[model samples]
Target: MNETYDKRIMKQKTHRLLEAIAALIISAIIALIFSFLVSVLSSSQVYAQRVAGREGLYRDSVYRRVIGQGSTSLSCYLSYPQGGSSVLRGYGHNAYELGKLGEFIRAALSDTLIYVRSVRVCGYCSVDGNYTSNEQLARKRSLGFMQFILSEYPFLRRYGIRADWVGEDWDQLRSLVASSTLNERDEILQIIDRVDIFSGREKLLMDLNGGAPYRMMEQLFFPLLRRVELTVEYDLHRIIEERYRRKLNDREFALLLEQEREKVRREERLLAEQRALKEKWQADSLAVEETARAQQARAQQAGAQESARRADEAAAAAYRRRREAAREASAARTEHRKLYPLWGVKTNLYALAGLTPQGERTTFMPNLEIEYFAFGRWSLSASALYAYWDFAQGEFWGVTSYTLEPRFWFSPTGLCRGLYTGLYARTGDFDIRRSVVEGVPTDNRTGTYYEAGASLGYVLPLSRHWYLEAGVSGGYRRVADKVYDVEQDKHYLVRNQSQSRLRLTDIRLNIGYRLGKKTIK
Candidate 1:
């Protein structure tokens, strides 16, 4: 009755521990999961845009001019020092032109989306000079500017440049004169038609109307002719290499649209100079050029819109790839964060109960089973126990035993956190005695025994590093023992060997702790 009561008490304590700790474990898990999600989401979100039309990364500097990519074309007009000089002057008329060039160059140089591919400088001289001298002057002017650009920004040399000079820009003069509201505009146009540059064209203009029309042309239309035009072509990185990519947002699209509008306005200005197609003027060719320029502007606008749509799609695709990569990374982290134990130490509650020859439990008994799972699924366990209880004359009952078991867990994790089965062999020595008191005889028994068996068990996790287990073993047992009866302080042997038996050898309900590294999360 007393042993049964003690066994019941141990079971109650185990249940109470489970109830008390489960609530705390659940609360901690909830807190940990919540904090992890918050951190992941916060770090994943990024709020920013591609700077205007371009931004750079370290890889951008090494990327070559991507071939077969779209191109950006730009043209600008500049003021100069003289007809033959290539030098840039800051204080004089050069100031206005330098300021314009500065703003334009800054934008191009800073843009990461494109690289300078080609530069073309076109120089034109006025009609007053002789053809050969004017041609020489224009050539020098174009050459000087091209050399200045290469020297100022040496990187442009990688792409190189082309220079074209117009010796006498009679076309530009005629166009400017036609647009002007000068009193001598009609007479000047007639004079230009009548004389060639080598055949006294400058002399006839000097003789016209006491040189009033000639002087006016030299002052007004001539300055417009003595100008240089610089054209730049850039290679779009997106066309060259997809690695240097950015999403085209509204701001970038608006900037492209404004550039297209500027082209249209420049075309309108040319149209003003080339208006009125009469037989004498023969302006049909100029009209055709203006129409073609307008068509080119339309094509550019269409290309920008298409590029923006494609860029947005590319950005979305890139985001999806990043999310997929993050999930793979998180799975790796989770695997590292969970732990599986390779070794354990445990005690069986049933062993300490009334299951032995003594038929009683004692707190002083020492029982331990050390289990080792060398790999994932297969394991070996060794159990040992020694018990000693003594009182007055011939009243002693105790046991000393050792057991070995080899186990296999069916669980995929092989943590023994689920069901498992094993085979076991055990050997032991025991002594039991009693004194003649209150109708009990003075009987003694000293014995040695061995058993071999198969076992089945289950292990349940009680905490991260703790487990509760139960199993039973049943097979053949062999015993060789001496039985004794004591009378008048003498001993009598009853048998030398007891019969072999097939029976249950052990019953187990164990509590174990895993020993290994701590879990990461």
Candidate 2:
């Protein structure tokens, strides 16, 4: 019977070993398949990137420029009222010219085989002030022009539109000086060429010939400088590479171009409707402004009459006020005899059930606070709190802390009943144990830490003396502790002591009682 039992036990052990070997073999096969898939995906990604790079190169090389320097470029000039973005009504013809330019851009964008890359709007300002002010003025003019364009043709926003400022254009000034019939043309040229800074140039011109050159430039070249210049960059679209173009027939390419043109026409119609709406809105806005101005004038006249009436009434009230003031002085003297306490003490119940570093564990804390109201709507406070924690399962033992806080309350009249904020300083000692394997205590040591933080909270009165409060505090804690390392299922002391910076976060809730005056209101 003993031999039979031994044979059965040996058979069971052999079967268990075979099952373990089978699982290992299956795991190896799955790992090899996963590695193969990763390598294939990496290769494909590299190849796709290379192909995209090549395609970009081909597009740049084969595409032709359509609407830049040598080709057709359009220009429209609009004048603005002095120091304003509104178009000058006397130069209303410029608006019509701008409308024509918009039509041309719309037509170009409608073309299926053309790609509009960008539109550049360069703004220039007159030499009316220092370089900084002029630069800002130029940018405003440029932005004003761009706004007008987008308002007129809302569809053009899709194209890259850039606004640039050339504050007091020196190049344009130089050109004007060269071509003008002024007597001081040579002197102006010499001044422009000699000075590199804008302020120096302005000063030189003002000093030259008793400021004659400056006045002439302001009248002639300055007006021209306060303008916006527009430039559009576009290119012909290339759908396929040069080598692949032979594969597509002419009819297919034409169909593609025709489809693109249809889309452009639809967008243009939508933009035209938007432009009409914008014009109607502007007309209504002008009418509203005119009405407001008339009403404002009438209000001013009424205000003057009302002021005179108030002056007459105020004279009569002054005589009566003197008689009333004497009576109130006697009453106030009797009320001033009552005395109120200016100090208060409170304690928080919620600090006892606070959370600890180990999520499931909680610490018991007791806190006390004292406050003094020194002036109107201002008070100062000081508080102290103590905490203790122990968690055998989490390897923590005998952790304790003490904190001191100083606070300032903004509403002294509503002390312990309104809003309060404060700062705190904390120091603590802890003894904890950790394991190489989870749930197994392998190392134990004690440490000390210190932290400082700020807190904000609101106090709501439950009764005349009791209050409920909630707040959050955060700061940095520096810890001095022993370090342990776990390897080969064994624990080793790496360092007897080490320092680490830790971030501390705490949420607080309080149920406290106040001793002193009740809420004022």
User: How many clashes (backbone atoms < 3 Å, residues ≥3 apart in a chain or on different chains) does model 1 have?
Assistant: 0
> For every candidate structure, what is the RMSD over all alpha carbons to the true structure, in angstroms?
26.8, 26.7
Q: Write the per-residue lDDT of candidate 1 for residues 301-375, one digit (tens) a residue.
A: 787666555545554554555465455545543443344777887877776553543344433344678998776
lDDT of 2 by residue, 155-249 (tens): 66877788888887888778988999999999889888888764387788889999987887888787777677777665323433222344456
Candidate 2 yields a Cα-based lDDT of: 0.57
Which parts of model 2 have CA positions greater than 4 angstroms off?
Answer: 1-75, 86-94, 103-113, 181-183, 236-521
lDDT of 2 at 448: 72
The runs of at least 3 residues in candidate 1 whose Cα sits more than 4 Å from the true structure, single-residue gaps closed, are 1-337, 357-364, 391-395, 434-441, 517-521
Top TM-score hit: 1
Per-model CA lDDT versus the true structure: 0.63, 0.57
TM value for model 2: 0.31
lDDT measured at residue 333 in model 1 versus the true structure, 0 to 100: 36
